[model samples]
Target: MKETVKTKRRSFKHLVPPVDLTGRIERSTRMDRTIHAVAKAVRRRLGPGRLRDLLHGVPTGKPLHPPLVTVSLGCWVATAVLDLTHADPRAARAVLTTGIATALPAAAAGITDWSSLHREQQRVGFVHAVANLTAVGLYAGSLALRLAGDDRRGRLLSFAALGAAGLGGQLGGHLAYRQAAGANHAESVAHLVPLGWHDLCELKDLPDGRPVARRLGYIDLFVLRVGEGVTVLADGCSHLAGPLHQGRLVSEDGSACVVCPWHGSTFRLSDGTVAHGPATAPQPSFETRIRRDGVLQVRPAPL
Candidate 1:
């Protein structure tokens, strides 16, 4: 007697990503570490003050990367339009020159932002930097050739540069929108929660020296009680939205502070001031009170 055997094939949809994709991620991760180390060394050599301010956009409400990228990429777009139409070489050259000038500041701002990101985000950012650098090289070559009166070669190089820039722009969008790398993590908490006092918990439920998590609607809050007074802040860290309740509580300059578990950015619990950074913005602090029912309450601080 003979026995029959049967096997069912797996669906293509159930298959995992190819091994090469995993290899690419690993390689990018290694490069991310190397880039970060090099950047740190360069920063140490430069020291601090104006250079740091320029990189972090200390004078601006947000990270400088977005505006710098917009200006440089906008110039490139104008040049690309001119190239496609075979417009005047002088006009194209002027646009390309402006783009090149803005590119340096954009790269500096991007590097500054990238250095503070987590490992996974850093992996994406590293590939982004490489793509941008390649584009820069192509554009620089194109500019040199154009200046030398070799319009044919210069135009071809500009097309290649545009392709590289498109790839880098895609990665940059993923970093900003998907990864939330440079977002103001606590901004939403300001609007979503009700304006008046919302009861958090009973005074007895809170621990004396520890932070407790409380949720109201879409907002998560970190509540800390010290004797009769309570401090309430948005649970998300402004840097990367790290859970503040999980962070260690410490005193900085005689004020109670919470250190973000992700990036070590510290915030004063009382006023939401940035005591330390990587975080350019402050945490969202709340006004707290003991309600008539003896329940703890919190409201968004006055603007």
Candidate 2:
């Protein structure tokens, strides 16, 4: 250490300020609050469970919004291309009409998507929606102007709309891919779980057929012993991480399922498959074996 030593310097080159979107952010936040209020009111009228099921395609076991949004984007692109290059006014009008018609379904799908998202995700989604709506308005105005003989003004407005839509699309991408909002959070749990089950509790400690809460290091697991076999799953529900241990166990078609206390999401005890929706991701399952000493041990199941 007395000799000359070179220290490796840390670089902050990749660090940058938050995207300079203060004005947009503020407007989006306000809008998000308004949307939140409206959504709450609507949910109250619709009933929470009904609203959740309706909006999230939980019954279908998939996200309904992403595909619908993609279709909207495609229609928007088609409209823009036609407006920019088509010599026939009829063709341009047709394309514009199609785009306008497409937006309604897109909005419906977006609303459904928004209902299942967390508060933070809803905030981001609000901004993304507003940006796309602005772009749609611009495109509509451009079309009107072009039809009224203001070709130059129409082209400018169309281009502006395109830019706004692009920005909105990018933000939506961040919300989905980057934040992993509305994504399956349980898929990675297998990797985090230790290879074998550590001690959870004595067999006598858990009531038969009732959900029992047990801890493994920092993670919480729910255990249900059926017959001689023990079923272990993440205690947190995949939908909103609601405590699964508090939920009731039901026998559905001869298989055991645990229903979430918060949102009623259900997971199968046999394989951790999602038996009901609002939760797209399956719960993490652990393989259970009785040790030679008669202690219960668990290991993460292979994918």
Candidate 3:
């Protein structure tokens, strides 16, 4: 006769308490999905072509949201401090008004950037937006109370608004630093690829009128050939790290361009200028030439 023992299989679910944790997780996941879907719809209606570019600071070559947020939040913080310290009421009123006004554009820019992010990043951004909206409401209430000559309630509301704003600022920092929502996706390509010309491929290997992906050291390069000339740009789109090599080549406004596969950010081939975007930064372009040996070589262009 043999004795046999049965053992239970291990599962991570076992570590979870016997509470309603599953239900809570399901609800949170559903909300996140809803938020992501709503952001996608808003982005489509807003159009990521030109208007989004303006919001993203493509013309200025940096994210506009950061500076705008700094000013907006700075004013609110100053107002809160002034109120707490029994400083000039007129100055506090002025700052609160300015903060409210500045927050409008800052929120707009933030939403524009938020719309282009992936689902995980969008979830964080959604909470961030909600917090800021709450702060704005509190500040508005404070302003109205101040106008009604209720200094005590106004100061209290301002304090609450400051707390909400601080929470929102913390989330914004997470989005920028942890999730990299507004950072350049292809910034590393410049540093990774050597400055000198590196042989890409033979001229015949790259067909004319097609966007081909090539590797130069650790960087992926998008190569396009157009009638006796070759154009090379970083393959990673600046917005959300979309693959430009898989994008369509189109002539927009008489300039050769490539549109991002993920977000449709269009970049000019000649100089890597942003043609249309949710992408704030331009793609890094490389200078290309065909040597007598029929080898195509590319090098980082001067900034």
Candidate 4:
């Protein structure tokens, strides 16, 4: 007797294209090439280690991009409102000028976040930067025209610039909220971890005053051996997941703290407390204990 067999075909339902924006968000290859060259030159001038730290915001345990972008957005909105309503010209000019002035610093913060991002994120960020820069130029021209007795022309130009800035802001929002670029991608790891200590590795494997990387199922932990005991923390830096295990262990008032190699965000080895700003969220700490067989074990702390 012949046996009947059935085969199932796989579907491509999950391969849907991303929602397209009203306007093209694609970056020019030539522009990207130029930016890459410039980034490399800047990196060389700053030195790899310093540049990496500057962009990483390790000290704050969070990426500086969001705040900077938010501030820029606020300035743009305020300036636009003032220009439209003919509200205090001095204040409008001040806000617009401040926004333009702050762009460089904000760009610095963004670059720090960008350094640790994936290739796709980097590409999106570069495009976002170009768009904002163009908007800034337009706004500057508008300001000049306004001061030169061309109020109507100035207002029109300002409105146009505001429109461009808004588009740039939307793209940035997409990069952050939608794409999760410059975000702590490993945040869900805490939820996945079990509530009890699990054998990680031998205690001796972790050197004194050094950060060691260990795995707890899907979660990566940065383990530090300070004194008689070991402390375990999320291995990925809260700022940009910059690999805290590569950071330096420093003593702050006789307490052990790990300094992130990326941006210098320091965390107490005992408990994940923000020793500094930038990183608003505390690093998720783990309950650490030694097993009977002299193995170091760790688990998620009680909520």
State the lDDT of candidate 4 residue by residue for 60-174, as single tens digits: 6566566776776788789889987889788887887788777777878776555445455556777777788888899889889878878788778878888888877877887
Whole-model lDDT, model 3: 0.85
Q: In candidate 1, what are the lDDT values of residues 1-303, reduced to their tens digit?
A: 898788897789657555544236534655755877866775575444456556766555467888999888998989999989999999999999999999998998888777768777778888888899999899999999999999999999999999999989978887888778888888888779879888888998899978888887798888888898888889988888899999988888899899888767778887988766667788988998887888988889986
Tell me how candidate 1 scores on lDDT. Answer: 0.83
By lDDT, is 1 or 4 better? 1
Give the per-residue lDDT of model 2 (tens digit) for 1-303. Answer: 589889999988678556646335534555666877866764455454544564566666676667766766776677568666856756665666566667666776566556556666677777788888998898789889878988778767877887888888887887778667667766556666767557766666667777788888768888988666788998877777888999988866788899888656778998888766567678888888876766778877776
By the lDDT metric, which is better: model 1 or model 2? 1
Worst 10 residues of 2 by lDDT: 20-29
Candidate 3 structure quality by residue, lDDT tens digits, 143-241: 999999998899899999889998788778878887788888988887898778888899988889888888888878888887778889999898778
Instruction: Go through the candidates in order and give the C-alpha RMSD of each one to the true structure.
Output: 6.7, 5.7, 7.6, 8.0
Better of 1 and 3 by lDDT: 3
Error of 2 at 288 (Å): 2.9
Stretches > 4 Å off in candidate 3:
1-28
Q: Would you estimate the TM-scores of all the predictions?
A: 0.78, 0.72, 0.88, 0.68
RMSD of 3: 7.6
